[model samples]
Target: MKVFLWNETGKEKEIMLEDDQITVPADKGKYIYEVLAEWKNGEISYTFVAEVQ
Candidate 1:
C-alpha cells in the first residue's frame, strides 16, 4: 500500500503516505493530472506519480 501525500495545496507536511498510492483527503479524480504534472520529476524522489480516484 505504498502511497504519497498528494496534497493539492503543495503542503508536504500534510501528507499521509503508504504503499502504491497517496492519502489525499480530497477527491483525486478532480485533481490528479494537475498534481502529477506539478510533482513529476523522474528523480529518486519518493513521490513521483499518483492516482486521482
Candidate 2:
C-alpha cells in the first residue's frame, strides 16, 4: 500500500505511513489524497479530499 497527498499548490508528495496509518498535515487547509493498494490478483486506487480547520 502507498499513500500520496497534494496541496493547493498542486504539488504531489508521498506520505509515510506508520502502522497502516497516516498523519495529516498540521497546516490548516484543504488537501487531496490518494490511496493505492496492489496485489497479485489486482490493484485499486481511490482519492479523497480532507479539510483541516
Candidate 3:
C-alpha cells in the first residue's frame, strides 16, 4: 500500500513509510490524500480531504 498527498494548488506527493504509519508535512491549506492498495485481486484507491494548519 502507498499513500499520496497534495494541496489543492499543487501536485501530489508520495508519502514514504518504514512501517504502517507515515508523516506528511503540509502547509496551511486544503489537501487531498489518496491511498493506493495493491492486492492479488486488483488495485484499489481511496481518497480523503484534509485541512492543515
For TM-score, the strongest prediction is: 2
When 2 and 3 are scored with lDDT, the better candidate is 2
Better of 2 and 3 by TM-score: 2
Model 1 weakest 10-residue run by lDDT? 30-39
lDDT of 3 by residue, 1-53 (tens): 98887666654688887678866556677668888899898999888877778
Runs of candidate 3 exceeding 4 Å displacement: 7-11
TM-score of each candidate? Answer: 0.23, 0.83, 0.67
Please give the distance, in angstroms, between residue 34's alpha carbon in candidate 1 and its true position after superposition: 15
Q: After superposition, how far is residue 11 of candidate 2 from its true place, in Å?
A: 6.0
TM-score: which is higher, 1 or 3? Answer: 3
lDDT of 1 by residue, 10-46 (tens): 6344344456345544555532312222335553334
RMSD of each: 7.7, 1.8, 2.5
**How well does candidate 3 score on lDDT at residue 1?**
90
Location of the lowest summed lDDT over 10 successive residues in candidate 3: 22-31
Angstrom error at residue 41, model 3: 1.2
lDDT of each: 0.41, 0.88, 0.77
Give the top-scoring candidate (lDDT): 2
